[model samples]
Target: MILTTCAACAAPLAHDAPRCVRCHTRYCNKTCQHDHWRRGHKQMCKKIHRGGNAEQYHADKKYKEAVAVAVEACADDTNGEEDFSTLRAAINYMGSLIQLQRSEEAKALYRKTLPVARRVLGESHEMTLGMRTNYAMAFCADPAATLDDLREALTILEETARTARRVFGGAHPSTRNIEGGLRQARARFALRELLGQAVPGELAPPEPQLAAAATPFAAASAIAGHLGMDPQEANAAIEELSELKARDPEAFAELMQAALSGEGADAGDQDP
Candidate 1:
């Protein structure tokens, strides 16, 4: 026989009571019944507590539980294969759970997630990188993730930015923005590490409006440096690029092809 329990408290409930009147939990007694509804369990409680196809509700619940279980299972293994999609879902849902102030459960989720992220992404992929960024936020969410944890998270972000810059390009949006952030996080971590305190504005805040924001000219300058060219040469190449845009616009539709193809200032370079 299946034991029915209160959705809210997980206590055993009476077979007859479908709706918890007090806490809106499925319950066995008038007290559980009255307490469920009487304690201001009107809106969200009612929705979660009642009126669904039993089999389907159970199935959906089971599916989410399975996902949670898989997340834990993966997290538990010291050396597990990368499961980026599952890690992404776990990060998102765990964030939501944290926002709801479900701290214990959220921490458990994070524990499982962090190891999987480290193992699978090898501390580099954007997903793992993103979670590193999120850890400080999780601390901000709960205020209990020790100062050390936040510092470690920021360290990971710095590494992430470096990897992005090297693997992608200085001009690529992710590389540019995240590298900038890594610089900031490094500065902050340095201060806190040395001085044992957070300094204001030490961490470079992410660009608020990434889409319309102008590309980082400094990155272009850096690329020029990396390629052993002066800023003027870079500008000239960019000017040549503008001319290319006018003549063969479609060739450089989504990106500045000169940068991507590394044909900077090469007169021989053609769109086709």
Candidate 2:
């Protein structure tokens, strides 16, 4: 039998005594429910009531209101420890913002959540690592994000992907998600440079060490096929990878390490 626990306090609950009407998160009693509401659920009620599947809630792309709801509810963190449930609600809200192309807000929430997650959940905790991946994806997805922003996003995704693979192994979905994000970040950053859309100085110049690694974007072809990106875009990404190998061997090597265990990466990546 599945044991159900209260969403707020994690106390075991009776079979069907009480649950929030909108979200249906269970609670042990009215007191816990009230406390959770005052802390966050009160705000979540209307957002969840937006009345459709998770995808439908964002159909109109109006996430500002839902974000506001999370912000207001998440504000009452009187308990010294960060409230995981409220924080998770905030993340979901931020995801909606990102889905709607509201990058600034999504990035802001990502910044806010990372440190708390690191502190409360530890850096290597699956949840913390997942947050890191989400944060990087949010930044990389933004058209307005800078060249420097791509650098930071890729760095985070690379390290997080490596760590997730080490911890959860290659089969876990989290590990797979990080791998996919790394591929996308690389493609986006490379494409931007290939198109001359980014500032030249923001990227490093080719280095001697990278001369040995200049194949560039072994992942782009697969990405192009999977995402239906233009073939030329994929080729440009490969050229960009070669440039990265020339410009910054360390970054190139990191990408290889991050990707080594997934997507049938070549055995040569093992050395990088």
Cα miss at 106, model 2 (Å)?
A: 1.8
TM-score of each: 0.33, 0.50
Q: Rate the local accuracy (lDDT) of all candidates.
A: 0.49, 0.62
Model 1: how far residue 3 lies from native, Å: 37
Cα lDDT tens digits for candidate 2, 63-99 = 5566656654664543443878656666666766666
Error (Å) of candidate 2 at residue 233 is 6.9
Which ranges in model 1 have alpha carbons more than 4 Å from their true place? 1-84, 97-107, 118-122, 176-272
The digit string of per-residue lDDT tens for model 1 on 63-109 reads: 66666666555545524335555677777667555445465677676
